[model samples]
Target: MIAWRAGAAYPPAGPFVPVAGGRLATLQAGPERNARGTVVLIHGASANAADPMEGVGRLLAARGFRVIAFDRPGHGWSDRLGAATPAAQADRIAEALGSLDPGPVIVLGHSWGGAAALALALDHPERVSGLVLVAPVALPFPQRVALPWYWRLAAQPPVAWLLSRTLGPPLALYYLRGASAQAFRPQPPSEGYLERARVPLAVRPGALLSNVEDLIGLPAALERQSPRYGSLSVPVLIVSGDADPLVRIEAQAEPLAKRIPGARLLRLPGLGHMVPWVAGDRLAEAVADFLPEAASTR
Candidate 1:
């Protein structure tokens, strides 16, 4: 099989690990022995293991933590495995972690992946010791924002199948650069982000379809899952950019911090949705500081 980087000249960052329906691609870093703790990185929509790996995985690894960034279910090199919701995706990730036999871990999830992290912490509590949510979309927005017509259309399975084979790839390729720019609006993307993050892999027909499915399905999933946030027992740190246009801080992070008891919210001024890329060092520092407290609970 082709590597997770798809057509990129370089090799895949890590190996594929077996899970339920299929395998997941994972990029691992740091020493295996005497590590601070395992930190799992989950990327948002239209991203792969490389996104968070490049964002903060290496930095955490360098700090004496074992870090693993997974291609969430269908996103990167991972098999789709019928993970249609964040909860389902979390189960799949939990299975992978079980096989790897890593004890309870600290999970850092960005954007939509934040929802997945919340699911992991709630449904598979034993798998996650703590959470670092960056620009997360864990709760339903305060106001209803209508989705674009194309997004709604793409959400349908029949249309999605046809479009994935016919129009999706080209359309995704056409919009990829603009979308990345918009996602990082008010803050330029870190240099060489596309290549380093293997972003082009996301535009492949299947991955693009999965992205639309994940995005369109998110709101309802959050509505169903949000009410359960109060039960999470792990230490949670929410880092968000107040100026984020995609996932608003007031609507998502601020409310989430309050919903989860003892959760801490750190709002960064003048920043945007791409917090992991633009402010990875700060995030690493936050993780380093929060980990001790997280470990204390265990």
Candidate 2:
């Protein structure tokens, strides 16, 4: 695992705690003495909490929020504890929340992280004050579509090894650009935009492999978890980009909005899956607006 930069501005805010036979790396920002509420952010597949949530953390902290982000097991600075199941990840999150000072907490997750967040709310509802899902990949089983053939071919063992060593980096870059182009509306994405967008793909080691596993496993996980959606009574916000290719807005977000009673859905007409980074400020504002009520004590 890559060692965290020593004396880095964003230092580890707490001790690494053992969870599910692995250690989770955690960081916190905002008031150290007294906090109003806490927001726990979980990043998408192949990316650690820091890479995806750093901008959001800064924005939330500026708005007087205690923001906590963690590298889930097997990613970034956290211990590799094999493939982490979504249920186990939620349990670890619950444990992390317990260790924090008492306060309301809003759990926010992106993509694969959203699946874990939903699982957490279902398994430990009392720990969460509300929920926010961004470009969430959670959907019912037997995915509406099949994996692209290239993705399937890449999953093969020997071929995967070769691709990882020889063409992975460039291919990863190409895919990022291509995906961003398709997702963005009106204007074409620039090199600078692609650079920031690709950061999540670049930072994680063995990202491709992990992403493949996530795509394969998530459908079943969502199928199992979908039935319990009605049981979630917490205020929920689901954000999705109408143009998002990675997750179909109509197929996933539309049904989810209708299913979760009183769930608020924000559909950005031309936005893409990279909305968190591409429009971080707007996303932050949405969260800020939604949080005030959820933050208030019931």
Candidate 3:
């Protein structure tokens, strides 16, 4: 894997923990002195845990809850484990949380990370207090991603090593800018978002492969998970942008809200996929309202 300089540019928000045969990077905050509950932030694909959740984590931390953000496997400083399976990724996170012992947690997952959040909630409902899935890719739509020829070859382990050695770096570098633009669509990134988020690192060979697997393998994962959504009894807040190009709200979010009984839906009129950057404060407020009252001493 061609590790990006940004991996060394700055460390993940917190230390790394050994879990699931790899190091999982975690960023944590909140005053444990009188914490109500834990809020676990799971970031989307191509972006690490820190960049996307930075603003919102501070907001939630100030609300008297412990906030923990994780670099999803193979993204940021976290070692690449079996990230292709959202279930495995969820298990890795659960193992990490077990080490922390924060008690039941409110999970906030964005985009691809939403799938992980859902899997965690599904498999371990006792551990998850509530869910705030933003622009989540939880439902399998009819049309799935059209994997690039390079991605097809990259997903294969035999040629993947060779492909990563030769073409992965350059391709990731080239596509990242356009990818960011698409993610923030109908509006550009907020000031310093590109650099602050370490956008270049998505080009790193490992991260790119993981990203491709996430895109290519998502439909089946969603298909497998969607049927069980009704069984999840946790309070859920489904937030999405009406103008989001990446995960269509009409196709994914609306139906998802219906699947989870009494799941609350919040729609931003024209925001794009990057809700934290586009409307962090508003989203935070909405989340605070949706969450079950956080006890003063959890």
Off by over 4 Å in 2: 1-15, 101-103, 141-146, 149-205, 296-298
> Tens digits of per-residue lDDT for model 2 on 145-261?
656777777777787667755676456655755655664443355445533322433323365565666666677777788889998888899999888877778877888888898
Q: What ranking of all candidate models by lDDT puts the best one first? A: 1, 3, 2
Model 1, C-alpha of 235: deviation from truth (Å): 0.5
lDDT string, candidate 3, 1-298, tens digits: 3464656765565878888688898877888767766789999878887765575887778887778898888887788787677787898999898888878888999988899999999997767888899999898765325455656666787677666657878776767677778878988967777787766667777777677777777777878888999988778888999999878899889999999987889999998899988888898787777665423212
Alpha-carbon RMSD, candidate 2: 4.2
Error of 3 at 107 (Å): 0.2
True lDDT of residue 152, candidate 2: 72
Candidate 2: residue 67 Cα off by (Å)? 0.8
Clash list (residue pairs), candidate 1: none
Give candidate 1's whole-model lDDT: 0.88
Report the lDDT tens digits of candidate 1 across residue range 81-193: 98979999999999999988889999999998999999999999988889999999898753237368778877899999888877777777778788889989899878898
Candidate 3 Cα deviation (angstroms), residue 240: 0.6
Best candidate, TM-score-wise? 1
In order of TM-score, best first, we have 1, 3, 2
lDDT of each: 0.88, 0.70, 0.80
